[model samples]
Target: MQQTKEQYNTGTATAKQPSHEADQSKTQRLRDKKVGDLMVNKRRLVEVPYTATLAHTMNALVANKVLAVPVAAPPGQWIGAGGSMIVEADKQTGTVRKHYIGLATMLDILAHIAGTEDQLMDEGVNDGFDLDQKMSVPVSTIIGQCLEGLSLWTLNPNTSIVDCMEVFSKGIHRALVPVDSHMDNVAGVELVESASSYRMLTQMDVLKFLKEHASSGSELDGILSRTVSDLGVVTERVFAITDRTKVIDAIKCMRIALLNAVPIVRSSDADNEEDHKQLVNGFGREVIGTFSATDLRGCHFATLKTWLPMSALDYTETVFANPLLASIASNTAGPTSRELVVCQSDTPLGQVIDKVVTKQVHRVWVVDQQGLLKGLISLTDIIRVTRFAIVAEPNP
Candidate 1:
């Protein structure tokens, strides 16, 4: 049947069209927001100068709870105090020229001065040494050697929660350094915790996951894989090595990566050469021993050194993944498992739980008196046990 517009009643039905303004608004909400929109300004920033004493720097760190600080050189002028240290015979004059050396950090000063208080005192430096004298060197001297460059990764203020999921998936530290597009000195920063998504998840979303999956009670003893802290696995003895080592020298890789411990197996034997000045593996490469960052940390000199052991920083190598452990821990459902938490055997479960909560850690390893691993308890184990208790309740 042929029908006219009037016969089809097309005139009576008006098609609803999407409001362009509304769609645009939605699109804008998801677009990358600029760091300038959300970064905390410099007035609120924590800044330490190159001349800052170790005592003052540590105080600032403790007060602000920050590990790294940008140290800039104090603008200085060239002085011809005694003319240049060099003698230009033809010119009959020496000129001391000054140039900007860039930034330095606490890590820098420590490297220049190694050894602990006792060692330094034994060497006649005295206890309660004056930090000003010890760390007074120009910031430029440490540049490239220690504090050459700093990188900052920024996300827009309006970036969606889904987009940031992967950023927080690992222990990348929620605090982000803020800077201009030119990558100049930092202007401000946006702490990851300040994002709206974090709050949204905390109040509206996390509880839902917990209600569905988490257990009400804690489980101190749970089955899990052996970790570096495990007894079967060795701890303590470690040898530090450079990153550029042969594949056959996997132990060297372990040392550089700062694992618990490793054997320093050479890639090839150096028996053929008489001088043996250079040790080479079978693959014609130098091999070194396996080393752990922990070994360095144990040394009294580590803390005083400008380049402190990586272990001193409060960062998790692993993150939470399976909020429910009995089922999905080993699968792709939970956080990335890398950092392992170690504690003494007599330490209370409450303390362990505190570490899990504050550090956002995934598992806890209880160690015996000899620093050997006892067992592990995953956050999932705690949640699963709690979940079972909650679900088994009779019609409450």
Candidate 2:
């Protein structure tokens, strides 16, 4: 999935600038900041229990306006305790501990529902089941069916701002910093329990920190001079699906790739005579739009609940056929898809940051001159680069 150096060079490139001595002091100050200073406090953390239903989890996310929430194991449930659970315990105290099992993002839930519907549609012929029956299943079962071995990235409380930048530079959006836990009395026994606290550090937080703390005009110039291509956070392999592909399939692709959204392209032969035939047969691939977790909001679970009884093919076709579904799709020319912000590979780091903050978008797609998808630059990527600039080797 790696793009060649040639591919990178083809896009508009930003020129390097000479650093000025006046900016040295401001850069050093930013470098000295700790990630803990910017982290959201644990006590105010919004989380869901591991046992929560899919509907409940979705509601929680929608209510909180967050993309993901931590899934914590129920207290007293330890691995090998006649249930499949993972936890940490003190050997000497012989006490069970509660722990964060994983994170459930909006994408994860969408993927599970979409994938499960696809599977059910396939199996529905042999096993006759109504939509209500299928929809009533537990979220735990869907998670087990759709996602296994999901790993979460975490950060320590003392992590330096520079180090935090490194993680974001790798294209990760958020990291959880676990608050230290102490012994507590549970069931009349003093035992170490999973820390119920975590601080979520997001790219926005980091960016806001830099914006507020930047001391001089030259400091902003110094930070913005870095090129996006040089940051090393953009994904090498791009993941996209054709416009005619099922929305569920798009969700599955994003889930598998851990992407926030997958570009919706026209069929590969869209420009050829065969392209018309494919489009007639529902195979147009001109990068018509993008499907992201945010799109899920347009279709309420309550609506899905009502549509569950229809055959999978009928359900998918009818649901996606709606123009509302296309609202979030980012296309080059459509009125709705125009909302998708985009840039070239050679876009400057600062310009990307300005667009992100001003537009309030999570990411911007990198496209070639021909309008073909190249890579993606996210707020996390920009934050990572900014962090690096503040802490580069010659700190004053």
Candidate 3:
């Protein structure tokens, strides 16, 4: 398969900008820089041709973690008398054509082919639609219908990050193509991954980390009691035990109550003066097996002890005695893969997203130090919350 120009560059560079230049104030920097200053190098672009398949396009987008591509014209050829001349051949004879196409942006192509915003929401299949079927829409149709006159802006190799942000804040476009004739037919394309209009801060990343690592903090004082504890306005109820109790029973309770998650606590002991509950420095509290609606599609639940069969498998006695039955037996005999990832109730939200993103976890349980389940947060929840905040915030 032919690769897009974007796939060619590894993005590693030895040349470093001076420290003084890098530390300029945001306002001062933006005023001094141009698009060419902030623009990524030509080799950094993610390029695709107009004729590439939608499946190919989508895969490239996902692999590169980018949303756009640059389309370019075929390269010119060298003539005996002239340096490099456009190859022109007779159309009827299938001769080489000297003319090359200039660069185009991914947003333009997506706008045309991805269906209108309305069409995508109403019919184009963005919300859990079949990816294969959706890929059939032609790029030409999309570009022709939606993004008229969308052209790739060329940027000098030395663009500054601030200037790139300014271009994004203007809400004009999301990609820049670099022109380098020596490279090949189509030079390359760069994805403006972030729009300057959006506020991005280091604090956001910090908060996200804290949320996911909330489980690592010291548990609240005297928070390990079997009974629910109230901290002024807040209260935590202990509903399940993970030690003596099997995961089967815990899952059963989760289903019956229609609860998103349940808190697992150590059973109370009378002999000890320092209560196990009191020893609760927040640790060992895990969200374990969220039953939220979002998880229904991804979990392998048939092995749970609480899993009452909605129906039974019918098979010949010989078939049941065969190797397939052994496979089922092995699976049924093992432990459930469900695990709990709990965070302190006070941890910031962004921290949670970062931790979970790296761990391949679907949800994080928020809890008090006593190992009690407070509430559950999912990745989807964060995204939905963030998007809402952006949309609802008053314009400055």
Candidate 4:
């Protein structure tokens, strides 16, 4: 008995489709969506000024509840400014209307406050933490100082989803999409700007969009249905800290590893004798909670005044002590607290996507049935998988 042409077309043709053509087909099916589709509520500028004092900057961040903000430079404030500084130009004016020099994060401020630069005060070497002086430092002074590797990417509203995925897949955590520009939908991004025209585009934004499209489009169904373990997206090599770790230690570890956040585990099977005796490995550990730079959102000018006149050692010991969870709990007046996001390795990729999108978390910790963390799946991993669609076993 021979198979009929219709039966072969329905079954064999789809299964045997060339992976290259299939990937291209998947890209084509969802390319219609544009960056502009992601909503920008109003045209008002939401960025912090380059000249704004860290005191004002901290307040702005806490008030806005944003982890980071774009540091916009006015044309005249280029005195002793480092680098060309103008990374992007307006499409309409062909000149920068409000130049965004670099980005500033809460981590940058907290790191500097914690003596990252460690300089002697003018009064005396022992007179540490000139709180007033430190708080009054301009935003421009520390914009690009603390986290040197942090980058800012610009995307036009006309950019395609595939291109955006490629950009994000390269491990870029932040991007600015210049909205209110008359878009010409070519394959490339051309950012147009007017006075006070700017908007943030996060990986979550695109991931949510992709999820919506993947739910409707049949092309991604086969890929999305696979387990994360099969997709090889779970990163086994991860950095984390224990709940017993101090707040200052957490900040220091995160800073050294160039990590924005780290998981709070109960224990770590780490050797203390290693030269690089900082980072806590959470593999097979019990994850309690997580800490990130954003958790320092509550520490601002008003809050700093209460802890005035404390030495660096005393300040750290008093505030940055053990049981990291209680020190930064939301109910208290110190930080915005922590969140725990987790999933099993065998969980479906589609379900993982749903979990991340719904929770609005940066990554999901991969755990065993007994609730021990095995690995993690970050947005970069998801984007990499989506960009390549490679199906392979998790690396050993």
What lDDT does model 2 reach? Answer: 0.54
Give per-residue lDDT, candidate 1, residue 39. Answer: 33
What range of 10 consecutive residues in model 1 has the weakest lDDT sum?
195-204
lDDT of 4 at 269: 41
What TM-scores do the predictions have? 0.32, 0.66, 0.29, 0.72
Better of 2 and 4 by TM-score: 4
lDDT by residue for model 3 (75-168), tens: 4421111121222234456354332122222333333333324333323223333334545554433332223124333323344333333333
Cα-based RMSD of the predictions, in order? 20.2, 10.9, 18.3, 10.1
State the lDDT of candidate 1 residue by residue for 319-362, as single tens digits.
12223321222331222333335555445444544565544444
lDDT of 2 by residue, 180-266 (tens): 533332221111233435566666666655554544553456656656776664654555665445454555556666666665565
Global lDDT of each candidate: 0.31, 0.54, 0.34, 0.63
The order of the candidates by lDDT, greatest first, is 4, 2, 3, 1
Off by over 4 Å in 1: 1-43, 50-56, 72-109, 115-132, 138-151, 160-354, 359-371, 374-396
RMSD score of candidate 2 (Å): 10.9
* Candidate 4 per-residue lDDT over residues 1-396, each given as its tens digit: 112222212224445678654434443445455666554342344677788998888887766656678887776465322342433346666575566667788878866665554232222224444678887888888876555324655677777767777788878765677654443344343322332256777787777766755643345677788899999999997787765565555665666677777777665346454322256678888876776665555554544533333322233334443344244443233332343678888898899888877765678899998878899999988988876662232222
Task: Give the per-residue Cα lDDT of candidate 2 at 227.
Answer: 65
Model 3: number of backbone collisions: 31
